[model samples]
Target chain A: MNYIKAFAPATVANVACGFDIFGFAIQEPGDTVEIRRRDEPGIVIADITGDEGRLPRSAEKNAVTVVMLHLLKHLGRTDFGCEVVLHKNMPLGSGMGSSAASAVAGVVALNELLGSPLSRKDLLPFAMEGERIASGSAHADNVGPSLLGGFVVIRSYTPLDIFSVPVPEDLYCTLVHPDIEINTKDARYILRNEVSLKNTIAQMGNVAGLVTGLMKSDYELISRSMVDVIIEPVRSILIPSFNEVKKAAIDNGALGCSISGSGPSMFALSRGIENATKAGEAMVRTFAEVGIDATMHLSGINDGGARVLESY
Target chain B: MNYIKAFAPATVANVACGFDIFGFAIQEPGDTVEIRRRDEPGIVIADITGDEGRLPRSAEKNAVTVVMLHLLKHLGRTDFGCEVVLHKNMPLGSGMGSSAASAVAGVVALNELLGSPLSRKDLLPFAMEGERIASGSAHADNVGPSLLGGFVVIRSYTPLDIFSVPVPEDLYCTLVHPDIEINTKDARYILRNEVSLKNTIAQMGNVAGLVTGLMKSDYELISRSMVDVIIEPVRSILIPSFNEVKKAAIDNGALGCSISGSGPSMFALSRGIENATKAGEAMVRTFAEVGIDATMHLSGINDGGARVLESY
Candidate 1:
């Protein structure tokens, strides 16, 4: 095959008290990339769509091409060339892992076109490099889930030990993305450098509970544990009607609701798809009450992360 | 039964990265309590052994009787009285949840004597009252495990939500108590009130990993995740040869080793009893090198927490 097309799912990070540790992928609102091999010696971003000309077009600055370059360099194929086209189906700066999806899709498509040299796990660092260029930090919570699929815990980042945890069969996510934009870097910076030890302990307890709840498929435990004591209290201010939206979701049968990642976007987990839809409508209605437009995506936890779509 | 005797196992709290959340029960070196109905209108500590006259004789101040009184009050039977005897088989202030064992044993024995008014789970807060009297905080990590058995996560303390997690069949604990004494209160006070957000995220990541590891029985994940970036670096100073002892255990095949609660005592988790024993021996020898004698208790995770021993 001279070319390949791939798709990668968007992700939600900092799932409640998990701050930089927890993330999970959703089936819809993802990114797609198409890659074609070239005889010339440099990668190029041939085209882009859905980003409204805001994303950088320069190959070095673009999330998709940067990831492709990293993978090619690692493979000792920097001498080779590729032409990339990114279809950004998800909104950028929505706290929905848009950049992560594009980066993962680019590398997966290129990897598939080049005879599939690396496994999906091997493509993670390349995707993370894409994140580092898009944001100041190379956080894996978004990239890990988008690349690996399912609910993932970035256990440690130094050596990059990340693994996927089990997702409940009936569990569904109601993702509500309000139109307002909150810069990830700014949201992260506003957080205090030092957190109270008491709050930290409480957060750790919830993290433990969340992980255990997911593994055991205990909805009550998950509901009780999905509390973010440290980050949400600060970051929620950046989002419009955050508390009311969360309350609406919770009141409408969401197991737990919180800011999806940095802000402007929120997610609610529910037991079944029907409950998830109801929760999503409640959240959207609450957002509308404050004269803010929002979009909702109802999806199960995506178990297949980035994968080849088709070959030409 | 006019009188009832019960035994409660000792526990290791803060099991590595868990701080105030994670704990598990050990099968040996526990405490026993015997309660007999009396005509007096108040709880009384009739006799005590193995305490070396160090424990409080006043029923209100004693860990065992204090827990019993709390239960009696909760049962609305404050007018009833009981004669209590506690056998403190484990060393106090050794970070082995000695007080928690006494507290749990007392409540369990009295409950059995009074026709088992509450489930083992219901006795947690009363047991924590004993912890509060012994130390300054009503933390449930110790008491939760001592009362419930097996590995447990005290998800929250406000409403007292504590639940047991699964343990691998072959998992064993090597608990090494050094000669030095470290007061839990003093150890806790020495810690800083605030922790860097970076360190807190790292800690939360490890907590998530450890819980997932235990549930999935992924020993490697457990080993990698059993880290305490926030607590251990500060608390370990109170334990002589702490670093060397930890290295010895790790080198000798322990899955992971850390201060067992606020320590002078340490615990190492391993896949099998053989590895646990070797790890224990290495830790003991390391302590001996520092001119501090140490005692080791190697046992599997206790599935039965507190139970009636005899009735007359």
Candidate 2:
């Protein structure tokens, strides 16, 4: 039943204070997964378009291949065979969950091609396994939004419970990606080993506010709750004009603004589409003024992640 | 124009994870205040009951008198004169906002006695000032809940911003007070200065779950989200049968259970009134089985803090 046709969606990761534990997919930015059945029983990955010369074809180091391999092994079909071609539709290592997008797209497409051997919920751990291939640890923030869409909060590490929050009708998101790169690993290493209790409490309050705001669908509360006192202070040092652009975006009437993930990219939220567009423009102008070329996206809240683009 | 009438309601302090920074008032277990116009401009205090002579009467030590003094000074009325009587409603230091209840009752009563000179919002600071007289520092976890009904969260220290969260319709709270006293200061002093980064991140995740749960009105999510990794470990040591009672209440169908405020008191939540009553009984039985007598409250979520019982 391995149809030669399949598709997977793209995602935006590092949602403000949520860091690696939250992410969501965008409608426009997505990957296509077209697979075909073969007599061989191992996963073979081919990186087309979006990934130029940097991606590996080997199944071992590849995130998607690892997950597919695990899936196949679990099904007692280690000899099962399929070749997954990932049209890397999103940028790689751009703080936008580019690699995760690839992994998710591959697994989702393969699963669909195999008549959905695993449920989407059952597929998350495999996706997370793919994430650990690069980040050295599994982080759910990006995987969740990529899979479930909308605002998400992770409640535990050992159990890894993910909670979806109600998105406000007026909610709009703006993403600004500068033409530069900062590896998440380097950024993570730079963080201090310890934080004071006072700062911890402050950060927790902000985190609580952010989650509550999303669930209540209170755009104003969501905007006010976006303050981050922990990772942002240290992480922002890697990105130029982070503060200036944030200030300009808010001044231009954005509800809240912060680094999108580990960035050369940043994000802002607004109560309406018009405000989101304007905020995006404000960010673009601010980043350009600081000598960083940037592009902005004014998008609405996404309610679905990766899905079958044309399922039977 | 002194109406000689005052009132203050019960408050839920240290609400959930906000610990020492959040609280809100209920219409029950409230205190009543009566003030009389005096020939002397300075404040005079008299007629305190329900404290059984274990309370202070000195104007400097009395929470009500201190608040009246602050209010008079704030209003630029040094000649302000009044005689006061207080009805001590809620039990003192029972982790039910006893201190804040008194402070709020005194200030609310004073506000009315002075011909409603200040609105409720304007009166919060002075009531918080009264709390400072006893706690040695200004903290609103007790005062905020005593003044405003429903749920609350506090985010900052300087200038003090309080966030009011929407309570779920099916929300029910059950409280169990053991016959013992464990001071807030003692609970605070037992806590370690440093927390593990891993634990802090876990705490952040749980907080996110909690806030979202409340906003979504997801009782199951709220129940699952009610966990403490930072302060509970240190504070739970002070309360006997803390774990036993918690296990019993939850096993008997409580949504979630945790120590109330500091110590010597604990509370559980449920989705329905019947379940709340069952939770209360379970809490009482658990404590009694461990040879500790306890008073329990099976109650609904209070939305309004205080009202004029009888205005003339």
Instruction: Summarize candidate 1's per-residue lDDT along A1-312 as a digit string, tens digits.
Output: 888989999899999898889999999989999888889988898899999999988998887897888888888988888888889998888999988899989988988988889888998899999888887899998999998999999989998999989988999998999998888889888999999998998999899888888888999999999999999999998987888989999999999999988867899999999999999999999999989999999999999888888898
User: Model 2 reaches what TM-score against the true structure?
Assistant: 0.94
lDDT of 2 at B146: 64
lDDT of 2 by residue, A1-312 (tens): 655444444455556666555565555565666666778767776446677867777888777778778777777777778777767766676776776776777777778877777887788888888878867678876677777767666677688688677777788888888888888788779887777777777777777667667766766667767887777888899988888999988998898888876776788888888888888998999889978889776677667777766543
Q: Where does candidate 2 stray beyond 4 Å?
A: A4-14, B1-7, B21-28
Q: Is the docking of candidate 2 incorrect, acceptable, medium or high quality?
A: medium
Top candidate on lDDT is 1
Quantify all predictions' global Cα lDDT against the true fold: 0.91, 0.74
Task: Give me the displacement of residue A297 in model 2, in angstroms.
Answer: 2.6
Which window of 10 residues has the lowest lDDT sum in candidate 1 chain B? B155-164
Q: How many pairs in model 2 have backbone atoms within 3 A of each other, for residues 3 or more apart or on separate chains, i.e. clashes?
A: 13
Model 1 lDDT per residue over B123-214, tens place: 88888999899998988988999998999998887877888789889899999999889898999989999999999999998988888888
